[model samples]
Target: MDIATLYNANINNITTAKNAFDVLATTFGKATEAWQHEIADRLTAEHWTGTTATSAGTQIKNLGSELQAAHQELSFVSKALADAAEGFAAAQAHLISALDDAKNAKLNVAPDGRLTWDNESTSPNFAGTDAEATAKEISKRITAALNEADHADQAIEQRLSHLAYNASSGTGLDAATVKQDQAAVAARDQVPATGTDPDGVKRWWDGLTEAQQQRFILNHPDQVGNLDGVPAIARDQANRINLQRSKQDLQLQLDHLGPEPAHTVKAGRGSVENADYSAWRTKHDDLQEKLHSINDIESRLAGDKLKFRDNTPAFLLGFDTKGKGRAIVSVNNPDTADNVVTFVPGTTSRFGTASGDVDKADEMARAAKQADSTKTTATIAWVGYDAPQSILPEAAYESWAQNAEKDLARFQIGLRSTHEGTPSHNVLMGHSYGSTTVGYTMRDHNLPVDDVVLVGSPGVGVDHAKDLNIDPSHVYVARGGDDIGIAIAAGTLNFGLDPTWDSFGAKHLPAGNSDHNHYWVKDSPSVRAFGEVAAGTWRL
Candidate 1:
């Protein structure tokens, strides 16, 4: 733990140990990966009959997952060993180099790390070229190196304790979670805080090599999953892992709570509180809600056959259980898309309704194709903010809209920052009160979208279209026949001018016949017009 002990430490043995474990982990991973693929389809009902086979098949499938889980644990240890060895080697190198400098300078470094004079030179009274200052600098570097090595050692110890806990605990390792949570601790330290602005974050991300990025994504998925400036591919991979781990964690909690929850029992001969029952009920309800939110996300990720319709894979950009809940689902990879339309839903939207929002995204993508079939497109259902959950008081206030302005603008810019090729024609389409949110985003932040489409909007935070800082010609609006009440809310509710009005300077797009939610009804003119905007072919 001290300078002398570290100075004499032999890290070659550590390297040898790390190399051996790396090989073992790789070999084991390959074997389990093979096992994972083996039983996935081969052990189904068709391969056998009745009870024993069905039970074996289920357990075998689980065994495959557990094998992968064990492989991940092995990998975590291997990675930790490698980190420890590297930390020690770097620290030792610094110390040795410093010692050599001291020796060359005719200065002596004491066993206790103090500077001393040589027997011939000055004898416990010498410094470096700059006297005391040089000695201090050398001492500082020496201490820093030792501290760094100590940190690495501590990290290994912590991970070892965690590994032990996983083994002794009845709950086994989850296949999808073990690697990122345990193996990626080192990478996580290198990441910028989640609070960093999108553009700054993008600079750091783009500076890294592709292999480094991939490693970060594999090991530190939680850190990058919801990051605005990260590319869609990385975000998707990270968020998918996040989704798996979230489900596993929540399911584990639910299992631990057990089936029978205590209910309220009478107290004395009078009405009284059942604190335990109340607490249990509250926790149960909250967990169930979170589970529902996660399930909604799972449903939307059902791949090509469901919402995606075509063979395009779903890209989950973000998901969170904050506020009412938040989810951002993209129908395709936005990084490579020629046109990207992001839909921000209105009041009462939550994670429970995530599936419907993604359905709308799919419908938007389909409608965009109707405008121009050749254009690569992505439609995103972005409920990335804490939307107002009530109609009476919450929706009447602009707090929700104001709070979302920064993130929405950063997200739009992040799309431009990380996109693969030519600039995408990005459209910000807001439905109902979502328009209010978009309006704030544009007016305050000068959100750089190619077009702004307002559907069934009450107002968009600005009185004049020009105030949004976009080309007035690019501003468009639509309404539903049943949304008259929403129109009355414009201006009077302090939400700004009605965008659908001729004086607002935004051209009117066709409104749907039915209701506010029918704007993207299949084959509707309203949907097609919105699609035209996404396709960059819409004209006044």
Candidate 2:
């Protein structure tokens, strides 16, 4: 089968469906509104003296209700079809762009799925100046274009099939119906599952055209942001776009609530309007907090230097405003770094507290550079899980750690997949409850990391370093002298044995006389040792 031909046909069908649904939606929508306001209301008001007249009124009311429901269903289908059409069109455009690039590069594809460079051009062209180099470049471009086209063709078919199913089965504009439609769309287009091979994801992502990448990022930001094996740069791009969209959506919701009443109390407390106002205010405040967090990241990126880096740029690797909020930011391009460190924060972590976490990551990056100025190091603040919000019993339990393990493991896989050259000396550093999350992830899944550092850790969900699936020599721990709470809870509220203890069979680092939060501070021994570990220069 010719993939290009198949894609073209699907694009045409989508366009036809979009136009047809639009017409039905507009016609039926107007008729339904007219029947309800003009005919149904009048029929209800009539003083029917005869039984036949009353019966006719009842039938008319029922018909009006049916028409209203039909109109709503039609409207929903129309929008769905329109969105599908737009997505198809974008996919088609990207495919065409890729084809154009292939053509410009003088690459030819045979029906048998093989690419060849047309070096013997009859027409005068820029072919022979650097024939070998040009041929290699053309081969690469054609390969990428073909891969993108193939993926796009498959995606379009799946989406169209799902849309057809929904158009036939969906009944009304209820929440369930809407949710079903959304789930169908997501299932069709979401990134590969967590269990998918990281290498496969890397190959697929590397082959996509820039336009195709942008399309996925805009259409399915959440999936792209969390997708294992996606490049940090691409994830960052998608998450930032998603962040902006979320803020806009929230603002629109606030605007729809209309202007606040003048007579309402100043704080909108203890009044009839208070509840509604308070709800909206809370949403608004959350939106602002996220916006502020994003702005802070942007400001750091704009600066000439971020900690140790002189010109390296910062990026937002992941983001979410749902729940308590989660974010992952990289202080440098991890893809090309010789060393990389991912830091996970502990309790009460949220987007509102991201600025400080990000600062600490920057400090880590700087310290890593100081440890070995010749090696490139990237440090990421990975608040990519819903960490416990409080120190309550529920939060202190191991269930939260279990729930977070898969996500953390997937994130580490993503880092490995996107690396450009030889694998970096990757390190996982966790503090407090964050250590529990890392421990569970390492023990449950095969995380591609070189070193593990647990600081102010309660326990690592295991009695010994052997259970962590890493070399005991590579497992490091640091506990501040003042972190009495963590020391006391080591065998109680903690998951299992404390890594810093001699019985845990892990290397212990000097942490200095500081508290839980000061481990990463400048001039701290703990921070310096962490830097050395991340740089692969530390010794026992």
Q: Using lDDT as the measure, which candidate wins? A: 1
Writing each residue's lDDT as its tens digit, candidate 2 over 156-273 gives 5654565556556644434455566556445434566655666777766654445556778888888787676888888878877876787677567656766653444555456444
Error of 2 at 405 (Å): 0.8
* CA lDDT, candidate 1, residue 243: 86
| Count of backbone collisions within predicted model 1 | 1
Candidate 1 structure quality by residue, lDDT tens digits, 1-540: 677888899998888887897898899888877766675565663679889987887888777778777777776667667666766777777778888877776677878888865343355544434756777777888787677667667656776677667657723367546755553554434777776777777876754434456667888888889898888888988988988888888778877886554465677786565677677777677678878777766666663345447565678898776556678999888999999999999988877677777878887888888889899779999988888888778999999999998889888988888888788999998988888999899899866698898888889887889999899888899987777678677746888888888888998888766476778777788888887888887776
* TM-score to true structure, per model: 0.62, 0.62
Alpha carbon lDDT of each predicted model: 0.78, 0.75
Total clashing pairs for each candidate: 1, 0
lDDT of 2: 0.75
Q: RMSD for each model, in Å, please?
A: 25.6, 11.6
**Cα lDDT for residue 416, model 2?**
88
